[model samples]
Target: MPELFHKVLKAFSSMKAGVLLLALLALFSALGSTLLPDSFNHLILFNILIIILFFNLSICTFNRCRRIKRLWGAGTGIIGGLRQWSLIILHIGVILILIGGMINNWFGESATLRLAEGEQALIAQDKSGVGVNIQLEGFEIELYENSMPSQYLSHVSLYKNSKLEQQSTISVNHPLRYEGIKIYQQSYGNLVEVETEGQGQVDSSTVLEGQILEIADSKWQVKVFKYVPDFDLAYGMESKSLQPNNPRVIYSLYQDKVMAGIGAAPLGEKIEIASGYYVEFKGIKPYTVLKVKEDPGLPYAGAGGILFMLGVVLAELKIFSKPGQGNGNRKAVVE
Candidate 1:
């Protein structure tokens, strides 16, 4: 029984075993990404590979450490001891990185936040039902002389439990980090403001592109199907450019859910709906889209990264670059 146990240990600690496990991991990862169904146990298989790789790394590190400690005790010199210990640190760093990545894969989550200017939304809720919210204070877009968008930004204020927190600006590639969550400025678009006034009733509302605007207690509703920034009649309702040079909206008006009229008009153009009811397109308003990601294992992976860099620095500096130093990949490691 003892011999069998030793053989099993030896197999796991072998370099061949490690390489085989890594190959299998890569193979299944590719298969899972391209072909495997999510309902399959590919996740379970991936976790099992992770566990075995962890064990393999642990055993190899233990064996290497034990051999290095023996040499240090027998006076193999300070340089030899330092080199071996550096390798040991590298091995430990790899183990920590693997564990942290697994934890992150299992626990992390992502969601999106969409807010028009002066709009508020709930970003996410924790296990205890405590929610985090953000309000879009303002949005801006910058364009080059050629009429192409150069940059866009969103000024936002965070809130927790109805209490205000600090405000921040988010732009492309610049994310706002608050309360262990990251909010990235993902995209921006225009919202159509619709206003109707008739029979002494004025109702106002906003609608995103390709959405409908309906009036309460009224038979008139309109679906703004498209928005063209640089409207050109010569292009058959297509925009000449993305500069909002001649902003126009194409819409289909409906009465009692039946199509009444279809037309295209510039922003703020009033379209007659009925004898005493009319709807006008207000100015375009910018809305911000944000991507929110929460990953709990970031700290763990960060610590592991520091340790790994420290190990590499130690190996590179070679505090005592004698003939017997540099790495610990000698026959002793195999033995």
Candidate 2:
């Protein structure tokens, strides 16, 4: 058993083994990234291979140092002791990091809120059993020179059940965190605006205006606002630019009676009135989208990574100690 340990250690402690491990890690990462969804089984196998590599390296470092106390110098003795301790720490750290990653990937909780101005919704579901509600006071998007999105801004308040908690303005990359919930701005769009103008001999005029709450699996639904031909506007006496083909309606979408979006669009066009809200095709302004997350295992992963690196450094030192030349007993041992 000791002989086998020595041999295994010798192989693992070799500079060649170190180089090979680096190459293998790189290759595995590349392959994992390139694997198609169809190749998920292959990807899982590769992930297992990586974990085995980590564990094997730790074991080998320990086995290699078992007989090093007999070397002819203090350098070899000290390095052997350090390698033994580092091997243990490295093994434990790798196990923790791997377990934490798996737990986070499969069990993490998340929710999406379709918030309108001055509206609130409870973010449902949490693995830790915590509940949170978020109120969106106002939401706005800014545009760049060519009308691409520049930033998203959301004024929000947080509550726990019925108690008011915290409030802040969230933007792209800047999330409002209350308790463990992270509210990230993922994306935004023109929640269509629909209206009817010039009620001149129209066949069926039931202006259905609302936001397409979501789009998934080729299915769509819109929250309908009341039907109106000449929807009253807060601005100047509703522009009378009524065209036979294109008519404009000026009304805003409200989640809780606050404007989520505002614009004017032609009525009865399949494109405009197709989805939830129908509005003129004004370019969407970029909103500051933010993503929120609460990763309980992130700190553990970071610590494990750091400890694993330290173990590698210690293991490297153990291998490079040159055995002293002796007068009568000098020999090249396998380990």
Q: What is the lDDT of residue 88 in candidate 1?
A: 75
Question: What does candidate 1's lDDT look like per residue over 20-96, in tens digits?
Answer: 98899888877787776432222788888878988998998898888887887777766566666776787788788
On TM-score, the leading prediction is: 1
**What TM-score would every model get versus the actual structure?**
0.73, 0.50
Q: Any idea what lDDT model 2 has? A: 0.52
Model 1 CA deviation exceeding 4 Å by range = 1-9, 19-46, 124-131, 193-206, 210-225, 233-241, 250-265, 269-283, 316-319, 324-335
**Candidate 1 structure, TM-score to reference:** 0.73
Error of 1 at 314 (Å): 3.0
lDDT of each: 0.80, 0.52
The local lDDT score (0 to 100) that residue 173 gets in candidate 1 is 90
